[model samples]
Target chain A: MSEHGERSAPGKGLVNGLAVTLKTMTRRSTTQQYPDVQPELPPRSRGVIALLEENCTVCMLCARECPDWCIYIDSHKEEVVVPGAARARQRNVLDRFDIDFSLCMYCGICIEVCPFDALHWSPEFEYSELDVLDLLHDKDRLGAWMPTVPPPPAHDVLGEPSKEEATAARKAAGPGAPTAARTARARPETPEPGK
Target chain B: MPLWLDLLVRVVAVVAAFLVLPLLVGQAEHKVMAHMQGRLGPMYAGAFHGWAQLVADGVKFVQKEDITPRDADRRVFQLAPVVALFPYLIVLLAIPLGPGGLVAQPLDVGLFFVLAVLGIGVVAVLMSAWASANKYSLLGGLRGAAQLLGYELPLVLAAASVAMAAGTLSLPGIVEAWSPWWLLWQAPAALVFFVSGLAEIRRPPFDMPIADSELVFGYMTEYTGLRFAFFLLAEYVGIIVIAALTTVLFLGGWHGPAAEHLGWLWTLLKVFAVSFVIIWLRVSYPRLREDQLQRLCWLVLVPVALAQLVLTAAVKVAL
Candidate 1:
């Protein structure tokens, strides 16, 4: 008996098998023409690690938190003059930064724990090399990949405004902040009751 | 006017049909199957859609080390490929390519000759399988022998229906006898022939002999380099033979309008059309299991072909 009770047929499976193949044979292929065309990657896809050089304070936080110990950082204390304050202030100046990608587990922990948004996951991962040693990317190479890192996704409209956005909005609302006030007007954020 | 020159010319033509044409057919198979599957097959070698890819592959195969098994029957292993390839070209010699019976030999019993010569390749396959001395190879050979034996019956019976309908056994003569189309008159027999012929060639829907997943490439497991290349070539050439025979028998070989002038071209078109259908079957159907293969041949095709035979005879007598 048929599933619907109208009619049952022998060898319907065979006909359906052929029909499926015929349908697939006519459908457009889902092949990605890689190398010639860039694939559409999600904004925060973890492909390769990148560094924002200016934001990296040589704090050694990324290196300490890294499970693989892939991140190596060096810095020297540089004295800077502070006008109308103490005679000189000493701050760590970044000297050398290297990421041995050969050892990188790519767990995104380094990017997560970074207090300063210095590390980002750039979705530009076509860095295959003949030699394993060539994969140990230095500061300049890591910094170069930062430009390829896509901007973070837009925040949820219905959700509470983020801390960064809320603080920036507060700054714009304060008197004498003119330039940021223009950006603040563009983004209409609902007032958080607690704030 | 010399007989030896006539023989030499015919030999060259056979060589051209089997050896030269298969390269183009192989290219077409790759390109067509790729398109059907929604991908570009070859884009590099010749720069304009990989025309030289086969040539490059041939060069690569030629360069590989010809490995032989430690305890193999060295002589049989060496000669099996030659056995596989040699006879089918002779079968091609007997087939008509155009109207007005445009064949090299056009012998009185050409149909029988073609079928007989085509069957010789099975021995080569068996020889390779047995010679390899591998258990898998032996199983593959056994499967091949059974498959070839099973399918050949229905194949011949299907052809018998065509012969009974047309009242002739010579291939070109059958073409001359066909009025509208052999396919219309002997549709069931044609189906039986096509399905059975696919089995004969050990192609998909019946390729239990070389079930790669199960038998590790079956009879060809131990072959390497040029020997393996020969077996591959033999299979493709067997496809050509099947296509040509189908064209001659069922499609009314070169019987198109203006076929006298464009007969060879029509023959080519029909042959390739049959080949395309075979490829279509390959893409659509999964390989039949060994038991399924046997059941299909014995229970289904053989009985159907016999019925079709009786029907054709009845129709012939009624007419």
Candidate 2:
């Protein structure tokens, strides 16, 4: 058996050597021309932070959850009417929200723990700046949408049928029925005491 | 111009050829090897598949830092690259590139002159090793000396066969006598010459002295930046010299169709072809064991070379 192993050694070695050479020849090169071709980062790629301003409820959850304390939020009380109520209710209005991305580790825990879906990961990685303070993204900078987002995966599109139906219904209804779907989707069984 | 002035012009022409042409040949070798292995090489460096890569590399190397080890023998460390580099340049003075392409007075003792000049490169390796004061460097230097000594005998014997057959040591004289190319006629001697040449240059399957993995870059472990680049340049230059010598002695030194008008072109093509094979062998084969390398030189190559030399002499006397 040992003699057989010795006899086959040279043959195996030749094959192994050729395999390595061929693999190196065919492998995709790791080098990238950074200034020329921008890399296509994935959907969840942690590059920078963006916010959905309309959906934010001023809960300050993102700021509270942030490990680095990079997120800063200030809010004030605002009147919001309860559904079918005569009197208005007081709630907190978000006055400021800022994220200093220079100090941010991009752990995505803030995004994950955000109840209002206000905080999101954006794929714009190129953010070089001369001033160290310029990298500190304030409320205005973080509020706008990123230019491009990787298209949602196929399974996500398939899973959200109501959203697709609502989009189709909106297209059919023309511009007149802006809030028709939301009104129709609201439950009527629960009654209000005063109206 | 006086005779001395004429000689100086010839020396300049030879130096230019040695310095410039080998770089072009090395570039061609890279492209050919890339094609054979199924890829495009250096397609963007210049207009045509990085033809100017060597030029770019040369500029970069010169602009790089010239570093020396703090503990090194500074004078010898600085001198090593110059010593390594100049011998290959001198060897090119003796090589006959083609008809009317003889650079200097073609000596009757051209073969011996080529060997003696090329042998000086080993001294550079030794100097680098000892001057660095590193154990691995010393081992590499010792290995280089032993390897060169072992291989040089077979290489000389192989060349002696061609000299004996042609009844001359002058390179142009040897080429002038070959009605058919000498390589085909003296097949055994050509084989011995090529194998020994590979060993002499320490190219792979015989690159024991500078085995990068085992010895951490061998004798050149301490050399960095421009000094290392010089050693690299000398290696490729040495490859070109060996290929040129092989062409002159065995492959009929530029004798081909259109013998006058296109002789230099044919000579360059042949030399480039041989150099490609050497580079291909480097990429294809793994390095041999040090003991195996020594054994192969002494046991196999020297005996084959000796036999060919004896056979060539006997045939010459009979003819």
Candidate 3:
């Protein structure tokens, strides 16, 4: 009954409303000045595709797997004498790597399928062109976005290093080096199959 | 003063009112309302605080395509904005800027003329809506008619109560009748006038006719280019006139210490002050439901206005 009576107080609601608006009117405004001030994007946000040329072995996996058939790759075999062996060897040297952005749907299948870790998602998505054909970015342009692809998020201090990093580190350290610390830290937390 | 000169002055005043006041009022509304809602409003287009935004907007409106729907009544659709805007511009002729014959004409029946001309805009709204042949526009037209029916009585009654107290139909006469405490004397009528006038102009809280969420720009939906600009201009003009009328009746026209010297300035200040409050009210209140709005006008405003009218007449006669 008291609550109902409060709601019925004639013009009280309107007065209260005016008071609220008046209070807000005096407070500092919260308008963002866009364009003039570029927004701070997250480091991990997927923006554009970047290519690491060194890691690419012309495996044709990204091109073969692309749903859009947008990734066009060309390569030629090069023969070279082995440094220690008595025989000559042939290797696929990359000739051309072009991603037709007009057709490349940015589905990230190319990035996911690169077995040699040859592709990355770069946070540099501001390449617009007047002509559609101009969007067919070649290897050099794709590689230009590589420097902007932020280094992978820092490894947590107390956590075990990733398998790739650990294996690479072990290889660099030598074959017989004991990976005892990593095993000790990880094995206890590993859940058994039934449990 | 020569007759031609007087005519020129009046024309200039009316024209200036149309051109200048709209821009000033538009800017003030945008800036003030933005502050009220915790926004920086317009920050570009004028070197500082978007002062030239209205000019840019005018240019944009002019350049836009004048689209006429294939099914629309071409003549009425074309004529609606001209009809809506000109009468309100003429209505300003009666409103006094300063004491001692500073108004455009200041007719003996000025209030009567103002009220009659005020109804023309609503007619234009309905005409444009009906002419559009759109279902939503038809609903908007119906809503406008319903609002006119619900609120017109209180609007007339509120103004009439003031006329009764003043013993004249002229706005300048009402100003003369006031004893500087006109607000206290005619407080109830003023309240009715403000609320009913909001309904009359189809402003927020009473803007069911232009309910954007449901009706998609309402009666002016199909209008484009300059025609749309005209409707927008008419709304701002409507707000100015209502504020000026309220000033004359309740706030005592140009009744301040410097009125003789700076009377027109005081009038401008008071008019904008009233407009500021209206904009504030717009931001503060949510749109009233159709049923709720009708109930307010009929159940509350009409009864109060009626009582105030009777009370004012009796007091006038007794005194």
Poorly placed runs, candidate 1 (over 4 Å) = A1-8, A36-40, A151-160, A167-195, B1-4
Candidate 2 residue A118 Cα shift, in angstroms, is 3.4
N/CA/C clash count, model 1:
0
Best by DockQ: 3
- Binned by DockQ into CAPRI classes (incorrect, acceptable, medium, high), candidate 2 is incorrect
DockQ of 2: 0.08
TM-score for the second chain in candidate 2?
0.93
Comparing 1 and 2 by lDDT, which wins?
A: 1
lDDT of model 3, residue B102 = 83
**Candidate order by TM-score, highest to lowest?**
1, 3, 2
DockQ of each: 0.45, 0.08, 0.64
Model 2 residue B292 distance off true place after TM-score fit, in angstroms:
3.5
- What would the per-residue lDDT of candidate 2 be over residues B94-146, giving only the tens digit for each residue? 77766874546588788888988878878998999899988898898899989
lDDT at A12, model 3: 80
Residue A28 of model 3, lDDT score: 93
| Evaluation by DockQ, superior candidate among 2 and 3 | 3
* DockQ value of candidate 3: 0.64
Each prediction's Cα lDDT score?
0.85, 0.79, 0.87
